[model samples]
Target: MLPSGTFVLGGAASGKSAWAESFCESSDLTLNYLATGQARDAEMDQRIKIHKDRRNDRWQTIEAPFDLAPALAALDGDSIVLIDCATMWLSNHMLAETDLAAAQDDLLLALQSCAAKWVMVSNEVGHGVVPDNALARQFRDAQGRLNIALAAHADLAVLVTAGLPLTLKGTLP
Candidate 1:
């Protein structure tokens, strides 16, 4: 059985992904990488390639940028899921002009029903300045709200800063 669920949050390039990976590697359960990022630009494509290269062949990589609920539902209980970053997922949804409320509902519902060990990644966006556009503002607000909700439900909520993981909600065993 899965030990528990966690949310690994951080700013850009804060080593959240690496730390979360280490946490998962330390476990004996089967690993599944649920990638939330998409190759939209040359830079993102390179980044995605780098991440893919870093992961071992033992892990099954699933690219689900928007509707992760379905992916989570399809997962077996014995596997561990690592959602690279919620920032990208939210960006994908916002770029598609998706229904934020319904999307969030689906996302949370997926998490609730997931049986495997899940380590979700999210960016800490509220510490930044206000956006100039309405859509940007809406995205920032939604990200903050979504992070808060996810953190509250997570068994372990950690903030990664300067490559350091700080426990904010739960203890690391």
Candidate 2:
């Protein structure tokens, strides 16, 4: 069977995206990198460049910072989609004051309708000190909820720590 949906969760700089990329490379399908990050600052721009440089030219990159669900829905079934990641996409919606519940529902619906194999990367944000500010706490909660939901929906789920993969749900394909 084609890799249906795989979720990769990890803390910051935990190499989850790199793992997901390599996982996609295991398949022979057309590779599609759906980037949800925006170059909002110099540091982020440099980080994005590093990520871009890591991928081979065979990956067709799609910038979907604000339109992840729609972009995902538009992909062909024969493609292997790597959404690296969902955290930034969530942040974008939160910053825009969008209805996150509704947005998440839409994203899940889009995923249900999608035919391509999916590898989704997201930050595991709940394993740290509590934020002092209300906005930060809210973001943390939302991210946690989103992560749980995605994990439940995924055919396979893996947690990355210290650059090691630990399968949480189904076996790695």
Candidate 3:
């Protein structure tokens, strides 16, 4: 059976994905890598490639840059699914100018109902200096709210920084 959900929060290049991968690796189940990123530019393409290169061939990757709920729902059995970010997923919705509230609700519902073990990764975007632009500020606020909502429902919530993990809720398995 899948264990209760886990939420891992951190900043960019802060080893959150690596940590989440490790958490998934701890289990004997097959690893399902649910990539939320979209390589819309050169930098993002490189970043996505780097992440892909780090993962072993055993992982099955699903590129659900916009449809996370359906992606989660479609997966069968008890494989461990690592969603390598909530922020990117949110960004996709924001950029598409979709209904943020409805998207959030759908994402949460999928997480709650998925049969597989899930280790969700999200960026902690609100701890730094406030964004000077309205769009940036809006994104930061949305990210924070998304993290909180996920953490609230997660059985284990961890904050990672400088490649170290600090558990916020439940013991690390």
- Each prediction's TM-score against the native? 0.94, 0.97, 0.96
Ranking by TM-score: 2, 3, 1
lDDT of 2 at 21: 91
- The better candidate by TM-score, 1 or 2, is 2
Clashes of each: 0, 0, 0
Q: Per-residue CA lDDT of candidate 3, range 45-68, in tens?
A: 999999999999789999898878
Local distance difference test, per candidate?
0.86, 0.89, 0.89
The TM-score between candidate 1 and the true structure equals 0.94
Off by over 4 Å in 1: 1-3
Q: For candidate 1, give the lDDT.
A: 0.86
Candidate 3, poorest ten consecutive residues by summed lDDT: 1-10
lDDT of 1 by residue, 14-54 (tens): 88888888888877878889998888789999988888898
CA shift of 37, model 1, Å: 1.4
For residue 168, what is the lDDT in candidate 2?
A: 98
